[model samples]
Target: MIKFESENVQKFAEACVDANSIDELLAGFNHLEADATDCKTWGITPAEWMDAIKAATAEKIRIWASENECPELLKAIAIWKNCPLEEVEIGGEGDIAAGNKWLDDDGLITFYRWNAATYGEAK
Candidate 1:
């Protein structure tokens, strides 16, 4: 179990309204963890932190889904839930060229193509 400061928990809790489903809720939940772990920032891990975070995520998702009119947030949440962190590139633009090379090496879909797919445009 991990512990989070009340103040930090509040920030993630507040963001729940922006989440539309359980999945979205969890993403926003884990986003907090990622933020905390970011060396450029600060974070707190509450006792039994993981469980508490999951519970918080679930509650927030339920509240947001019921209160907000948009279901897309839920879908976004689903996508976030299944995200492969190992496949994610965490750095900035400075890594673009190398990232591109890695993508080619991996035979993975390019961001351009992904954007096109999102917009229903053929790439």
Candidate 2:
């Protein structure tokens, strides 16, 4: 059962990855799953999980825009700065190389990057 509201959980998950800290990123993913489980307890489906991931990833793009003072992240996700939200995969070689010091290359944070290509469970 997802505890946090869908929107809130997604936003926080995105923030977890955007944050320049591995601890923060892990916390974010953990929170996201917990939140989803809370929702699942009430009967959220795999489709909902996909939706949440997309929404959360899009939220990260918004945060990136506001924080970076640029649209690089948004561009990476192919979202317009002032328009309906859109989601895109994030992370790549650069994000992967930034592991531990940041988080694993496949960490949600890295996977949340605009061009992120691959992802897997954190084990």
lDDT of 1 by residue, 10-79 (tens): 4544443344454454454445554434222225454333434454544442333345423343333233
Write candidate 2's Cα lDDT for 19-121 as tens digits.
5343343344445454555355535555554444444443443344344432454343333112222333223322211211322323334445424332221
Q: What is the TM-score of each candidate against the true structure?
A: 0.28, 0.31
Model 2 Cα shift for residue 41 (angstroms): 2.8
Q: How far in Å is the alpha carbon of 106 misplaced in model 1?
A: 39
Off by over 4 Å in 2: 1-39, 70-123
How does candidate 1 fare on TM-score?
A: 0.28
RMSD of 1: 14.5
By summed lDDT, the worst window of 10 consecutive residues in model 1 runs over: 90-99
lDDT (Cα atoms) of all candidates against the true structure = 0.37, 0.39
Candidate 1 residue 122 Cα shift, in angstroms, is: 30
